[model samples]
Target: MRFAHLRVEGQTTPRLAVVEGESAIFLDEVMRRAPRDLQDLIEQGPEGLARVRSAVGAAEPGTSVGAAEPARGAVDPVASDPAAPGTLPRHPVADLRHSSAVLRPAQVIAIGANYAAHASELKLRSETAMTIFSLWPNSLTAHGATTTWPEDLTTQVDYEAELGVIIGRPARGVHARDALDYVWGYTVVNDITARDIQFSEAQWSRCKSFDGFTPTGPVVVTADEIPDPQELWLTTNLDGSIMQDASTSEMVRSVAEIISLLSRSATIPPGTLISTGSPGGAGYSRKPPVFLRDGSTVTVSIGGIGSLTTHCRVI
Candidate 1:
């Protein structure tokens, strides 16, 4: 199943909805006391997800129960309401605005240099410890949102396409082989970075935590829908050129390994978004270095999970 936080353009609050191909079934309209957001739903555990599935049962007239669903699609996001319970309204997803995919997450943790190719391209040693950093909540934005950064602070702004993992439950001392059991779902992330600030700073959070630096989602696909996280492909299209392209399989450490390693010391809480790092082809590493300028439209996509597009502006 796929989920997202969507709202009508003028609405102040985002509604939690079950995303279909081009439309959405808002859980609030179908179920009484629906989980408020993806984070809330995940915290309710498997039982809550079961209740949602049951509430949205056959909302799509022709879709068979337990049918093979698309991981998720390009959902700009929109909503509508049905008059009664058990009868779900199909809102045209293209008409809605989005909030960050994982709102009110326990925390946002990012893994750097997990992909050997990306590490090699950036000249970061991947042979040592995992490079982990925190992304401030202010950095979280949504699909189709505009991210503006101070012109004086950065010129070498770059994009990193990464697969985001949402933790389903508390995890501590879990083994890599069973680490996925704690995964609730996945989303696409554009880890926008300020190349100049990044190089000058000792810590990464501040450089990458500028408001709207981390734009996530269009939708989040359940872990069950993704049979193997490692096999997915990732890409970054800056304006019109394909700057970054590689498969998640090329990561120096797999998703399960990252989770297992993280859980070793700290308890990973439900709804914690772990951006599992990016692959090779960062613009900063390109021959004639490419950077995000004013009016840039960057789209990062993870096959099956959907694409996240962000507009850029210099303030």
Candidate 2:
């Protein structure tokens, strides 16, 4: 099942909800002891998920959720009607706001130069040891949120479209063949970066970890739904133009390989989010860089997952 952290307007707390097309079923409304967030649900393991599945399945269709229906006059009529096409006892996703897809992830590891084209364009070596970096948790933000940076800091801000993998179980020394079994789900990520800082700093984490730099979600799709991560397509749209269009098939290191390689030395704990590098077509490599500016809107989309959009502002 697909899940997202969403909240109604005027609320500061985000609640985990199961997404069904354009509607969202807040888990607390259906399950008495629902996991508070995606991290909690993932840590609960298979039994936890099974319980959720059973509870959601047991509820009568079109009953406005099992026992914790929305407060009176709060339901959207179009999404609650039993006869309405694809209706459920749910609220329209359009009515809700999003939080980071994987809140409180154990860690956010990023793979760099994992795509041949992206590596070649940046003049970085892809044949050598993997270029891995940690993204600061403060950088994490939700889809549709605004990401701003000071103008004096850097002018070459760019967007990278990438796939995010969330681990389901502890993974250490796992073979490539078995790496995927540990995956919990997938989400879209826009690895926004400040190109100027990236090249000057010896390490990459700081340049890319500006507040709101990593915009993820809309939703996370459980691994069972994605049979092959490499078959997906990733694209980036800046303003109104399509800037990056590529396939996961283009990665120099497949998702399984990256996981296995990382697991060789350290235990990849459950709820860890690994951003599997971005494809080429970065604005920095354009004839004249097309950096994000105040009022610019960028979106990164991964097939089967969802699109994550960020509005940019330069102070």
TM-score of each: 0.92, 0.92
Q: List ranges where model 1 is wrong by over 4 Å.
A: 62-86
Show the colliding residue pairs in model 1.
77-96, 78-96
Tens digits of per-residue lDDT, candidate 1, 139-222, equal 999999999999887888999999999999999999999999999999999999998999998999998899999999989999
* Regions of model 2 farther than 4 Å from truth: 59-88
Candidates' C-alpha lDDT: 0.87, 0.88
Clashes of each: 2, 0
lDDT (tens digit, per residue) of candidate 2 on 188-262: 999999999999999999999999999999999999999999999999999999999999999999999999999
Q: Model 1 TM-score? A: 0.92
Q: What is the model-wide C-alpha lDDT for candidate 2?
A: 0.88
- Consecutive 10-residue window with the lowest summed lDDT within model 1: 67-76
lDDT of 2 at 5: 97
- Candidate 1 root-mean-square deviation in Å: 6.1
